[model samples]
Target: MVLDAIYRGELLPCENNMEGNGRHKQAGKEIEQLLKDLRNNLSEEDMALVDQMLEQTLIICDTECSDAFQYGFSAGLLLMQEVQEILRKRVDTAAHGVF
Candidate 1:
């Protein structure tokens, strides 16, 4: 089932529709207000530089989030494999009357 979903392009980790926590939402609002305030005070050139920095920061954040998701998914798969193997061994032992 999971493989079929992946094959159909349905498993998107980074494209979630969930909202961030309250603290993160508040921080984002504060950042937006700060940017607006800065826009009124800073020169156009400086604002452009700030925008470039923000863009770069966003890129870095996206890369980090993607890498983290990949790592978590790999870890989950390994855990599932381990659980299945343990269960299989238990079943085999029980069948052999080894308790």
Candidate 2:
């Protein structure tokens, strides 16, 4: 079943077709920006963030991935929920020159 899921995902035409592929590229760019913001503090690269999140989320979800792998998707996604909020707050604060 896991193999089937992985296989099915491989065949998704979104790569050659564009039913929903565009969303991911946009999301990727956002993640790239966030990771860039983060890399200012850490030493990791943007691609490294994706690689780490994929590996971590797979371990975290431990689901029966299929063409619709339900492993809930990302380590950073979970982290980002919180981090994004914090960053926003920091930005709001910094805008006022409060540091």
- lDDT scores of the candidates, listed in order: 0.91, 0.68
lDDT of 2 by residue, 1-99 (tens): 757867778654324454567796798789778767776766557657766987898676444343333334555478879899999999999999998
Residue ranges of candidate 1 with Cα displaced over 4 Å: 1-12, 15-20
User: Which residue pairs come into collision in candidate 2?
Assistant: 5-66
Compare the candidates by TM-score and give the number of the best one: 1
Q: Which 10 consecutive residues of model 2 have the lowest summed lDDT? A: 63-72
For candidate 1, report its TM-score: 0.84
Give the per-residue lDDT of model 1 (tens digit) for 16-49.
Answer: 5345667877998999999999999999999999
For model 1, which pairs clash?
none
Prediction-by-prediction clash tally: 0, 1
